[model samples]
Target chain A: MDSRVWDNRAWLFVVPVMAFVLFSSLIPMMTVVNYSFQDSMGQNSFFWNGPGWFQNLLDPTTAVGARFQGALLRNFAFSFTVLAIEIPLGIAVALCIPKSGWRVGAVLVAIALPLLIPYNVVGTIWQLFSRTDIGLLGVALGRSGVPFNVTQNAGSAWAVIVLMDVWHWTSMVALLCYAGLKAIPDAYYQAARIDGANRWSVFRNIELPKLRKVLVIAMLLRFMGSFMIYTEPFTVTGGGPGEDTSFLSIDLVKMALGQVDLGNAAAYSLVYNLITLTVCWMFFTYTTHADSKDVA
Target chain B: MLDRIGLKRGDEVHIADASLELHAGSMNVLLGPTLSGKTTLMRLMAGLDRPTSGRLVEDGRDVTGLGVKHRSVAMVYQQFVNYPTLSVYENIASPLRVQGLPKAEIESRVARAAKLMRLEPMLKRTPAQLSGGQQQRTALARALVKQAKLVLLDEPLANLDYKLREELREELPRIFAETGAILVYATTEPAEALLLRGSTATLREGRITQVGPSAALYREPGNLDAARVFSDPPLNELALTVSNGVAALADGSRLPGDGALGALPDGAATLGFRADAAAAAVAVGGDGRDPSHPAFPGTVAVTEISGSESFVHIATDAGLGTLVCLVEGVHAFEPGDRAEARLDLARAFAFGADGRRIAARPAAAPRREPVPA
Candidate 1:
């Protein structure tokens, strides 16, 4: 048997990317780590606090600790709600798209239009669109005799945020599922039909199973995006009528930039990053493991 | 009664005016070249596609507008299509489950199909874990479990390797025999059509050129296209002239037309014969000067030895083009070697200019000892 020659020359191609990432991500992350344990008093003066902020942040008796706890729970709730709404709705939309026709491209483009908009622009658009005096949705809801105000009510704020998120990002999930659906050979559908499978059976056995990989990726991306969401909610309802819709990312920005508590904010950022990474890794591991079990 | 079954997409016609009657409990082979509408015809029969203008009648009932879901048909595609995520057992039981059959009945049927396809060992594994042939067997088992009245196999073995193809080909007929369903198999390979040994419908350019028993179609093709479709190495066609009920070749050799000429006006015609009907030999010591067999003098162009038989291609000196002859065992005739190829007139076919066979020569009498010339 011939063994492969070990050549260090291949590392030459990867060095540039490594250097770029080192400056772009790793160094900034290290900065956050450095700031997490140190207290800063204006004018670049710093003193090592050594986990004092972490202790305060973990103790719910304090005001900052209570805010962090509330924000963390709200972030988990938001991510779960977004996933629950988007996955099934995206699948339904993908299934509704015509498999083959002159209009397939047109429909796909229409569904993907929202995803092309900037995240801040999406937030701004929904913000205006939900104004009670001028915006169509708010005006329509007002004239229809319903008490709907995202600016003042936490429930309505959450509803509008979830709706905006679904409108803006469900298309990504749908497009992924559509691509997965198209990759399935026509023979599979033909075989299902020949087997006397009904519409539900075909969707369950053929389409759903085929879309598993794409759905996993979609779920992971959506979860991470929603967990780290700031721009959209910050622009739409400014993190709520109170602290109701302020997710962990918004709370981190508030703690670091609003109150200038760099040490506590940095600690919160690390914890936030850790939770997101841990959840995403768990999702990836579970899906790939389940996929392997299917093959075995 | 499928009257004028045709499918046209925009300006191009896929299947045009093709009509067929598929009998139950009989295997029918759709023999054609690539893009010959064989798959289109199978799809129409399986209710996978609607014909532009035709009515499909089954057991005296018209099922023209019926979709595949309502039709009692099972199809095995060229690609072994199975639910990749489901185990072989689930794949085979899917159709039964869709029909809401009892668990016991579904299990028994799935087991039986698995046994028939020799897939019992791999039933617990998914398609991704199985080899190509095993995956195809799983697909076949799924189709078999349905036990539909019409079973359509659209070049199911075309994607398999030679050994796997041969193994599955041998088992398929036996598997379908027990179902007693009307089996319609489509293939582009003529050898496969012959191996299946079923009634064949030859397709050409979206048209049903001929339909008959496989052996009869092979021995006496209805037209030139059918003959070409049914031949492996292809038939040797030569332009010849007929005069006084005798077809004469360019080399001054004549074959007695007798009753085989079929009242043709003496004129130019085409004669075709298989490679096996002709024998090539080096003329030595007057060995090949047989009076009964017409001989053409030629130079050996190429020789191919394939196991038990050899194919000798000879270029005639009379500008009659090259003729291929299949001889038993090996012949030591290299290129440029002088040789004579004797044509067996009994197996020759005469065709008119319109590409329709005018006559088929009768099988020759049993060979007698060569008399002295």
Candidate 2:
């Protein structure tokens, strides 16, 4: 194995990226930390509170605690729902796509189209598409008289948001799976055939086990993306009809930018970041532990 | 016939029709060069590949269409075909599992196979972790784990070092003896075929050219090509002519060998004899009148000595052309030494112009054992 050398020369290439990240993230983080330690009196005047904002965050009796927990639960629910629908569907689509020559190129282009559009554009497109008067989906629902109004209805808004996400991001999972599928040597399939494995047995014994790594990666990415979802649901529902469609990020933004309580917002942002990190860490630990158990 | 249970690549009708009958408990070696379709034929025999035209028959019943898994025939391929993902134990037990055998039976068979192959200690190791020889043994054990009726080995020892090959060659026969199954092994080496100690078949260009016991084929090949196929240094072939009672050569020198010249057809003939069949001696005092043992005077052209014996390539004026005489013991003979080469009368082979073996005359009767009487 080639041991890595701590070449200061390589830092020349990485320094720009680090600098950009520091400017974009570290500076804002320091500002948040500064705000998190003080209470803002009107006109940017601050009084030192010394973890007062953290105490308010921890206390369930506080208004902030109640709203944060509710939004967190809703975020978890949304992420799980999207994952439940997308992973298997993505895998199925990937498997069904023809794997040879020109046909694969066509299928790849078709699958990649949804991922190529910008994130905000995706939100705007869905926003317009789900409108009652101008959108085909809304028009069809209206024609069918299926009482559908995503802006006012929490269930409908959640369904549309989940569907929009599955439509946009399922391709990522499919592409990963397709790559995994392509990497499998044809000899393995030949061996399976010689073993007299039926179709289901082939899938169970070979395909599923081989796909384990990529599927976990796909699940983690989808979970993180769906958990932090903001643009599409926010654009469509405006976090409106009360707090019906307000996810965790939506609530955090509402506190930060809507209420202009910089101290409280900074505290909420820190809590939000910690929650995402904790969940992701837990997921990673669970999967790696399960894999080690299986290997043993 | 294609109807045999062990028919590998389907036999083609356009080719010569031949059926192989290997008795149970016998080891049949398929000997041929690479790409000569030995592996294809073995796969057909193992029921891995179906012959498009012929039927595979087992005990007079057609089994041509049966798949490899259902045939109860195990094949160890030329390539290391062990399952990379499975440990040695699992690989051996796979055949039993496929057969839907009981757990106890599977366990016993796997244990017995691992023990026989000396792979018990490495049962938990994956194929990649095993050495080349160990991997090959695992492949062999996997075949033997299921009580297969016919075991096909496709150059199973080709990948091993010479030392390992020698060791495994000694080990394999004992393993086969214990199993009591019909073993069909293919190899490019004639020595391997000889080591098999059973009936041997030679394949060339997808056709079986010859089949017989190894010793007989080595000693008295069926034809000129078969004779050439057996010898290590290869048999020496010379063109000869029959005129008067002498076999005259192109150099116009007549041989003094006492052969049944009367038995040969008049005109051209190719005399075939192995290098070892010629007795090398200095100009000896003998009449050379024996009709069986013929003699020729020739100049030694080349001498290759290896330990106990040396081969002298003789350039003779006789129609024998170039004769290789095998001389035992060390002799101080340079390339230009005048030498008398004697043919081991009974051992010489004669081939006709069309590359077929010609019959020789009946041997002279041996003298009675008067002293014993």
Best by lDDT: 1
TM-score of chain A of 1: 0.92
Q: What share of the true interface contacts does candidate 2 keep?
A: 0.13
Q: Give the CAPRI rating of model 2.
A: incorrect
Each candidate's DockQ: 0.41, 0.10
Residue A157 lDDT, candidate 1, scale 0-100 = 92
Tens digits of per-residue lDDT for model 1, B1-373: 4667888888989888887787777788999999998888888888888888768898999998689888898889888798877888999998898889999999999989998888889889888889889989988888888889989899999999999999889889878878888888999998888888878889999988888888778877878888878876767878877777777776566653334545555787888888887898885535545444567779999999986888999898878899898889977889999987777767777787788888656656665533211
TM-scores of all candidate predictions against the true structure: 0.85, 0.64
Candidate 1 segments whose C-alpha is farther than 4 A from its true place: A1-10, A290-296, B1-4, B8-11, B67-70, B84-87, B97-104, B121-126, B234-350, B362-373
lDDT of each: 0.85, 0.76
- In the order shown, the candidates' Cα RMSDs to the true structure are 5.3, 9.4
Q: After aligning candidate 2 to the native by TM-score, how far in Å is the CA of B252 from where it should be?
A: 23
Cα lDDT tens digits for candidate 1, A125-238: 999999998999999999999899998988889989999999999999999988988988888888887877778878987888888888889999999999899999999999
**TM-score for candidate 2:** 0.64
For candidate 2, lDDT tens digit of each residue in B59-109? 676777688667657777656666656788988887677778899999998
DockQ of candidate model 1: 0.41
